[model samples]
Target: MTTTAAAHTDLDGTLPPLAEPWDPAEFETRLRAVGEERYHDRHPFNVRMHSGDLSPSELRRWIGNRFHYQRHIPVKDALITAKLDTPALRRMWLRRIQDHDGPAEGEGGIERWLRLGEAAGLERQAMLRGDTVLPGVRLAVDGYVNFCRLRSPLEAVAASLTELSAPDLMRARIEAFERHYPWIGTEGLAYFRSRVSQGRRDSREALDLVLAWARTRDDQERAVAALRFKCDVLWSLLDAVDAAGHREPA
Candidate 1:
């Protein structure tokens, strides 16, 4: 049968049900597994980035395109916060927004990313407008924001668990930028540096929330699927960047 038919059969109970609920440790293992196999850190663009293969223009293009994603971080976090029913959960989730958007002007991850764009030779105003960002990048980012807005709160929180693997990638990226892209300026690395610690903290909180909430087999499966969907989102963004081709010389 075709894949769609198989899915319909499974939904109709023609196929056996999924296995029982995993222990918390097992569930955590499964969630991390999604990142292991699918995280964008393994994407070709990142591979070339770490290996010092991307040209200055290629690097600038990535910075510009990725800024589109960066700018949306707080927006997605706000959606997740809005889905939360408890004050405690909302309070905890609100920090993500603060981290990305900050309390004042000229602060936060969004601002730091724009600094990186400037360091990469992109005009600050143009990067802010995002007019030159690749179409695929915009679509991928919008899809992720919509996922958080539409999915269950539990699934949305689980999706943000991609932060679990982000610290390692951020650290490696800082090293790569410092060693290979020395001309980009030290200030530009601040975004990656800030994320290393923030990613770990955010992932821990998200994992705890997922572990507490995903109590049933179906819930566990959905949480895992949410994480996988997020991995695909990141991977698709990179795929789009790769397809758009590295920036050509002026």
Candidate 2:
């Protein structure tokens, strides 16, 4: 099944069409299947955290470690935004940062995450400074920013498709936090809970943007690859955090 724009020309000037293309239903399936196979919900750490299987210390490590990724949201969006030459593109991408960082200091996802940290017993200063971030997590997120800056806008947006799979993970995080970490009050987990609602709206809009703009077969392939790249970025971050929990005493 190929969509109207699903043909491609190769280096040798041979033409090929994608095995599957943008039939509306097929497109939706492909886009969503990417999330089903690769989303963080499938990651072991996420599984453990949400299943009430992690210890308090493990939960704390996750919160502290993920603060690094949460902080990088604005930075990555800025990098992606820098590559956009059009106000339209800028307008759409900028909202991602706004959604996370909020309109002012006391608002948005980052500050909410801080409240979460404070509730978890981690120091605000340490989290704000990113002093406790794992080295691997930093490397992975930096790579995502670099990919967005260097790749085409379609690809950059595709990389953001992990957000498509994020709402489910957010729900699981909230459920787990509420059930297992009662010591951490609603104020602390409020950030994570808020994100479930926001991530759904944001990711849906972003996915539509990518799908609508990715008209050609080559474009779709690149878009899919970019999404896979993003999944690795997310998966690696979790892997780093989970691995840290297993490190032995020196």
Candidate 3:
């Protein structure tokens, strides 16, 4: 994606300009529009995956590289949780960490994702070590974690709004994996199935927090930029995976 000067400078490089404070509904519309235009679901790599066109190597590579992002999910959520001022908000955010990390061993989203990697022929130990993740994928995932650690709590929560688009993607991915990649057993798809409900609940909570907290025009603009930044992180991860597929084999 091209980053035009206008795109970065629209809000004067610090905050986005809003003509006026947006009502909750309008703010939501704007946030959804950002996802519509920039979400990773539109990336060619994902499009191909959904269309049953990816090679086995491409699929495995994606599975392995994405594990890097998956493992970091709880880490980023921890950062966001730390930024919360109230015990109630912290408790609510803590569920996100628990959702990914689970309360016990051999469970949770990370474990489920490793099951997916194993289904794709990746070694669980190597994936857990992130040994096969591409450099670009590493950079993108790390940037997101750092963004959450450094940005304001509200902006960090807004970045998580990408969850709004995740349920649909998870549904499509479950169907595509079953239809096109039967070699990947149904058990491996547990991650996607669980995410359908989790994504909706998480996105709703995050969106409510953003809407309630972002009261000023500047706050709304920053929230939008935060979401856009997150979209870029996901898009860039797919871009790296796509580029890797096109490179000549050694």
Task: Sort by lDDT, best first.
Answer: 3, 1, 2
Candidate 1 global lDDT: 0.90
Show the lowest summed lDDT stretch of 10 residues, model 2. 2-11
* lDDT (10s digit) by residue, model 1, range 91-130: 9889889888977999999988889998889999999888
Best by TM-score: 3
In the range 57-127, model 2's lDDT, one tens digit per residue, is 77777788888888888888888788778998799879888978899879998898888888988899988
lDDT of 1 at 231: 91
- Give the residue spans of candidate 3 off by over 4 A: 1-18
Instruction: Point out the higher-scoring one by lDDT: 2 or 3.
Output: 3
**Poorest stretch of ten by lDDT in candidate 1:** 1-10
lDDT of 3 by residue, 125-147 (tens): 99988787899999999999999
Which residue pairs collide in model 1, if any? Answer: none
